[model samples]
Target: MSIRFAIVGCGRISERHAQHISNVGELVAVCDIVREKAEGLAEKYGAKAYTDLDEMLRYEKEVEVVAICSPNGLHAAQTIAALQAEKHVICEKPMAINPYDCGEMIKAAERANRRLFVVKQNRFNPPVAAVKELIDAGKLGQIYSVHLSCYWNRHNAYYANSWKGTKALDGGTLYTQFSHFIDLLYWMFGDVKEVTAYTANYHHQGIIEFEDTGVVNLRFYNGTLGSVHYTVNSYQKNMEGSLTIFGEKGTVKIGGQYLNELEYQQIEGIEIKDLPPGNPPNQYGNYVGSMSNHDHVYANLVQVLTNNGIIATNGFEGLKTVEIIDKIYTAAKPL
Candidate 1:
């Protein structure tokens, strides 16, 4: 039986979820504050359309999974509500704007005995997966450090009269744009033990309430140090989103527009073989971002829901991502 799915937001990211969910799941309904957006997606999939989440969940009770593509800040509340409604949830990245909110969502999931999955699709990138395999195999011994860079452009036009530019909804660049990179750090390394950071709004000052540029220094529980330098201040387009790791025996670099390629590698006895091309990065009207692997995420979701498989990005993992971001933001003084 196909898992019945309903989307809570029909925004830009929902395009990815709607396009691929039909393969392994049935899109039974779509809900959005904007009725037109919900109707648009609903008509395409022949699903019911709703203007409110509670209305959809109340009437379209067959929905087995709630795929939340809502704004960053709304993820926790929406996810908890869906869980309380007895539906499994697959939330878009950042999980929530804060660690406490994420904790609440997780608690709700536990009480409802439902799964809470976070979408970290980049983990499905071939290079990323291969690198993870090496790390797990202990080929990269004593993983010393990691360096991450994310430089992209988000002009004033991108935020003009939009919820994205606000602190309450979008949070900041780290939440909206670089959360995936932050997640990758947690996924690869263990819990972060320490963090120091600084942030700035050099370009998008009045346009956005939070920083458009930031740098973070991290120390993982294993005593491995790491650093992240990210910005949405690139002039014309995205500059890079790359992650390089140095280990006792190997060094690897996963660099590309969206962590798509295995740019560099030097392992003692292991060879990085021919890797298949990865899914393309998401392209908005004028913006581009992390790899578009929602299909892979859906596949995993289907496996977990249908075959009782484990989630690659579970609630705890999602909470950790938010917690790390919270730590960084807390460490950074006013920009």
Candidate 2:
């Protein structure tokens, strides 16, 4: 039984979602507020195009999974609606702008008895996966500290004609651009017990509603401390999206434009071997972004629905990512 799919937003990321869904499932319909965008994707897949989500849900009863790529604020409501319509939902990152909305989404999934997934595809990166395995195998020993450095460029032109950089819909830089990095921090370091930080809108002050740069210090439940220094004010291009984990036994750093390369690995006695190359970066029309691993996410979704395998990044983990972001924002006020 193939998972039947529908896409709620036909933006840049939707192309990745549709491409992967076509491989693992059937694309029954696509919906967007813009008719042309919806029609374009629908025609490409030979599926129905809808301008309204409700209409798509009511008509496309065969759509078992809805992949939402809408704005941050709309994620929770749209997810709840899809779940109520008896469809599982795989939402694009951040889950929601705030934890409260994330909680509501989880509740709706529970009430509707449908699976809710969040796209944290970076977790599928080969190097990142390898590091996680090392930690799980107790090879990394007791973790001590983690550092995340995200220095990327988001210019005025990038946010010029876009809804990005808004408080209401797009949320801040942490939610918009660096959420995946923050997700990795939570995933690798563990639950944040405390955080203190500061933020600034150094470059795009007039353009974006929130910070273009920030620094945060975190203390985890396991006594591991972490720091995050992120910015979209890179001089000309994206400098790096890298994570360095220092532990009792080893210190490993995964660095590259998209965390695809294993920059450094040093352990006490064991050797890390034979890591396949990570996924290539996602190429949007105007800009290049994170690793392109939505295929793995879809593969997991297929196995979960058809073969009873567990969801790789389930709703709770997704909520935790959002929760951690909220804590950072609450602690990191503007300068």
Error of 1 at 49 (Å): 1.0
- Give the alpha carbon lDDT tens digit for every residue of 212-242 in model 2: 9999999999999999999988887888999
Each prediction's total of clashing residue pairs, residues at least 3 apart in sequence or on different chains, is: 0, 0
**Which segments of model 1 are wrong by more than 4 Å?**
none
Please state the error at residue 222 of candidate 1 in Å: 0.3
| Regions of candidate 2 where Cα sits further than 4 Å from its true position | none
lDDT of 1 by residue, 151-184 (tens): 8888788898778978899998899999998898
lDDT of 2: 0.90
- The per-residue C-alpha lDDT of model 1 at residue 49 equals 91
